[model samples]
Target: MSQPDQAPDQAPDQAFDVIISGGGLVGLTLALALDQGGLKIAVIDRLAAEAVLEESFDGRAAAIGFAAYRMMETLGIAQHLGEVQPIEHILVSDGRIGTPGRQGGPSALTLHFDHRETGSGTEPLGWMIENRRNRLALDIQVATRPGITRFTQDEILDIQVEPGAVRAKLKSGTKITAPLLVGAEGRGSFVRKKAGIRTYGWGYDQTAIVTTVAMEQPHGGVAHEYFLPTGPFAILPLTGNRANIVWSEKTSRAKALLSLSPAALEAELARRFGDFLGKVTLDAPVWSWPLSLELAATWAKPRITLAGDAAHGIHPIAGQGLNLGLKDVAALAETLVEAKALGQDLGDLTVLERYAQWRRTDTMTLAISCDAFVRLFSNDIGPIRALRTLGLGLVDALGPARRFFASHAGGDVGDLPRLLRGESLSPALN
Candidate 1:
């Protein structure tokens, strides 16, 4: 890592309320959430703001849950995100050739979830947003907030936990102190490592190839998932008749497939995607990410805590990675703010413990659920495939079960954080 630029006036003795490493989505959102509390916050990142958005599309997008959408609204950043596309329905199906002996006669089972059925009214279950857009909105919000200080082109060289504060040394020879330190640095977080925290998880032997495609027909704001033997192939609705595709395949095969010509790649995609959307053409550069399931052994200790991918990384089969991180920002912010009101040290063990306890169960549950779904559906075993198809059929036949899943997808599960519950942390921006 390169050295950070030094601040001429050093105030190591003066402490900030929080020092967050890695100014990605989670870190920036957390900073905004704490901005209203009259606390001093400093966010450090290695990359400059402009460098983060140099690429268009970048083959990455996030499925922002309804609750997260509301949280963004409370943060006064949602409206700034360009071209929000709602996903009104989600369709899941198993794409496997069945024998004639099957009871359903080789018909593919479809499980559909509609947001309107759950009294969400006209509101969407979630919005599909390009990752860069979300980051840009966050950067703008952070820049406009009065109490937040942002440090770009800065890298953390070392961290030390003192009796009353956590001190961080930047490579630029500048030092900062804060009562609480948050790690939002992503999967391979340097902050988590400096704090001596350990994680337990394994990588799946799969690589996810992501890109955008222009389809003959409009997506109609529907998200489609096809469970093939290799992995799950998802087509998320985008603005203007375009769909974002995330196709997970075996590692070796993914490398070879990625090497194919654009025409060859489009041909393979159309073959697997079928003609439901008519002929599809590649519209963006392809990007690939390895699949993994990672969980930190502990979320908080002393004045240190972890959030977002820094704490837990799960399968994208459910598109809940960013949603989960947003939840973390909400929970941790709430805990600290409420603690301050009650005259408790924001970094007190009891206060941090509360935040950890609030998030542990939900994070683990989602991780296990996604992992299980990926494993159960990503195999071509005859008996297992039959069981899964039957299960989907049963879910489709049941109304209450379908609604339950829909509610979960709409981000209505668990003890929601205040922002996610549609309560404003600060006054709405005009």
Candidate 2:
């Protein structure tokens, strides 16, 4: 093994069936998925695995949709997740900050999503696991898979896309080649940029303040979204008497709020948090992320392709960020596995376009919807507010409409890949 932060000088040039840049959650997931289907994968990441696996490295968590969760389970990665929380119900409401109820709670006008109504019977909407826990799980799974090799604390210095393969030179002086290269490195993807793909996006002028809180009372597996004038404040249930808070606010207000002392910050949080979950105390250091909506002009180019945030970065209003990326992994893996089985060139644009087409509409629709939600709900215009509130209530009352929304949130909409459908990615299953 190479020393920490240093690549082995004796490491010879390597080749893989697929080379994935940025071994983040999305990249690692793709590596494992393709590896399961008998593809040799090389995952190169700039950050060391040991550094990123630390608990303090990332305090954030993700809401893994049922379908994405199934993909992980299908890839044999779910068992390593230490512990997780299920979201049995979701409550959406529009209200001002000082509204009355359980001491400044949501208005009576609310949209409620019950897991039972989602047509899946007892299945929860999604599972919530801390980001570090997920990384740990991926690391554990990666270690056991001989087909997947990882190079950490290394970055692609340059990329060369040939007619038959994509070659990458690492900063550590290592050369790697693959039939296909995937950029899963979040917004500023090196692979996408090297492919000369353009992107279109805009900042929301909003920032999400995230932190975990210990609640005096159990959350009952319920998630809450309160639309205030500033932005949406979401309380996502976590295991044990705890919940994750995604409090979106104007960047200016978020900055000011974050600058406050711990007690002051908790006081502000308590006002929006209300007494629904009893007294809530911060259990972790707060983190803030600037919100934005970005989409690549295209997801594929010759020997190179993009997945996860590299392909599309959407607002987190719906908590579908990670799930969307996982969906990309499933689609791309299925496409590549089947193509390889057919003796087709994995780097061929024709084969990659299939993966792109399968994801284009789904990703675009979600991105637009999330942006719309952010705009529509982050306001107090009387008529608009009333209309949106009425809309929420209407959707909640109509069984069919409610179920459709619930099902969509559960990632059961549109055509699903084999991995998402809880099937093996083996081409034999095709």
Candidate 3:
């Protein structure tokens, strides 16, 4: 088990190199990354430090893209998260839930992405690991690193960013100073909000109901994404004969579904699940998230910068939210480490803008793509449905295109950071 969160042996008045406002996955990873690169960090969050070290399961699991998985491995956290289920094959199809295929058989406009074709050298498309497992693993990892302090149950009331310093006033009446401030807080980031960074996003009329399901048959390491008029229904593989269900429906219908008796919910699951898994039963309580796409207007200003959900939040249709956050961790870590090597101030607007520039285009591209997918797939229009059915067939037939998309979905497409590439952190310093 990891030790409780505490500061280093330095003077109580000493300033830190960086202070992160949210100590969830991204914040913790950043602290680990920067401290490895020789920077002191302070992390503050509302979660109790003791509880964070336990084997807590949050009911939601994340799809770790292959690149992000490599980054985790490089950070020495991957090996500790036990029993990750790899996605060997992904099958996508368009079908109405209660509607059958043509000729009263089964719809066959299936699109597939095979992991073997990704040129990733035996790596699967990605791995599905529970959020709790990742959090637990990181909790242990952070306790062993020096100069990385975690202050749980602490809230920052306000932030003042000066030319080369950031002073954060906590509700507990503590004033912590650091050269740079980073917000890994969620979409409703208080720090980002205080910094006057506007956000633009819209809610889908849909909600996603998530839970684990046990079945009579093994999953065989395959993932399924079935597009319904309501939204995409994702069945991700887990160890043994279990899978995670991310089922989407209209907000009202979802609320009704969640409010039903256990038997009623089981019948509802059977209506969409078919006989593929065989004898499915709910293994846990159903959890839900209202679908939305939220993007920060600006990622950085002067001594402060935003990462993870603070910067952008998107639809989970592609399961890239956490992976994207990890990308931000890698990118910000690389940027700040290199900047320090050049004798640059980590909080300078010029330095911060470089990080923002490197990330803005990619984040927007993902946001737009998620919006397009939700719009195209979540509609009941007859013509659009027919076109999508045809598109699925066409995409399946195009081998090279399918392979490229698979790799892209696996987080192998654009400019990758050193961490994602499985390289050492700050090679010169090492």
Candidate 4:
């Protein structure tokens, strides 16, 4: 083992089947998924193991969709998750406080989604896992995952590409050469920029304030999304009487609200958080994120590709960011595993294009739909508000339509990959 912040104990001129930039949750998941194809993989991350293992990781939570949960199980890490909260029911409502005709009675124009709506009566629609717990699981999963090498606290300084191979040089004087390179980094991917992929999108005038809250009453395993005029405020149930809060507001207001004292912040929270959950108080540091929409013009290059937030970033109104990345994991894993089994070069542009083609339409459709959702719900216009409320009501009244929406949001209603369907990646294993 290498010392802290040092290169791994391997040959200086190590080679791998795939070299991945970024050791984040998405990146680690991708590495594990590709390893199932019997391909050697190397992960380069600047964060130290200690930082990744810390108990307070960004103080955030991820909503693992039903399909995403299955993918996690296939990667051999789901059972290791310390604890997770089940979201058996989801409620969507329009009109936040200060909006016209908004009385804040529970939630106005509400739409409820039941887990049975997905036709899986025994399973939850989704699970809420803490970011810290997920990262810890990834650390252990990567350590146990075969065909993969982890380079912690090491940065990829430069990359030299050729038709046959790509060589990545690290700051610690270690060099790795591979035919396939992936950028699972976040939106500002160093590999994506090096591969000459351009991104286009704009930041919303809104910002999301995230934190966990402890409630006086149980959450009943329900998630709530209250569409405020400024943005959406969500209370996602956590392991106990605690729930994760993602309150979106105008950038200016969020800034002011974040500056409030603990008492003032709790007061503001109660204003948006209804009494349904009883008293609510902040249980963690309040964090805010600027909402935005950005997508890579293309998902792949000669011998390089991107996944997760590196490829697309959408508004969090739907809480599908991580789910989208998990979908990428499933699709890319399926693509690479299928290609390797056929004796095709996994790095071949044609082979990589298959992955891109598989994801292109679905990703864009999600981005556009999320953007439209934000646009529609963020408006305070009376007629538009009434129309959206009626729309929610219609869906609520229509059982089939409600179920369709439920399954779609649960991420079990689309063209799924083998991993997401709980199938083996390697045909021999099957």
Q: Per-candidate TM vs. native?
A: 0.93, 0.96, 0.93, 0.95
lDDT of 4 by residue, 259-289 (tens): 9999999888887775666788889877778
**Model 4 spans > 4 angstroms off:** 1-12, 98-105
| Model 2 stretches astray by more than 4 angstroms | 1-12, 100-102, 427-430
lDDT of 1 by residue, 1-430 (tens): 9778556445344468899998988999999888865567999998888888866535688889888888899888897897789998888888753334332111356888877544365678799998888889998888888799887999888889888789888866678888889999999999888888999999889999999899997779999888888898888998888988999999999999999999999988876776667889998899999999999999988889999999999989989999999999999988887787687877778899999999999888889999999999999988998899999989988988987777676677778889887675552321
Model 2 scores worst on lDDT over the 10 consecutive residues at 3-12
Q: What value of lDDT does candidate 1 attain over all alpha carbons?
A: 0.85
Lowest summed-lDDT stretch of 10 residues in model 4? 98-107
lDDT measured at residue 35 in model 3 versus the true structure, 0 to 100: 80
Better of 1 and 4 by lDDT: 4
Report the lDDT of model 3 for residue 19: 94
Off by over 4 Å in 1: 1-14, 97-108, 117-121, 427-430
Q: Taking the candidates one at a time, how many backbone clashes does each contain?
A: 1, 0, 0, 0
- The local distance difference test score of each candidate is 0.85, 0.89, 0.84, 0.86
Query: Candidate order by lDDT, highest to lowest?
Result: 2, 4, 1, 3
Provide the lDDT at 405 for model 3: 74
**Candidate 3 lDDT by residue in tens digits, 405-427:** 78767778778888888886855
In model 1, state the lDDT of residue 323.
90
Top lDDT prediction, candidate number? 2
lDDT of 1 at 105: 12
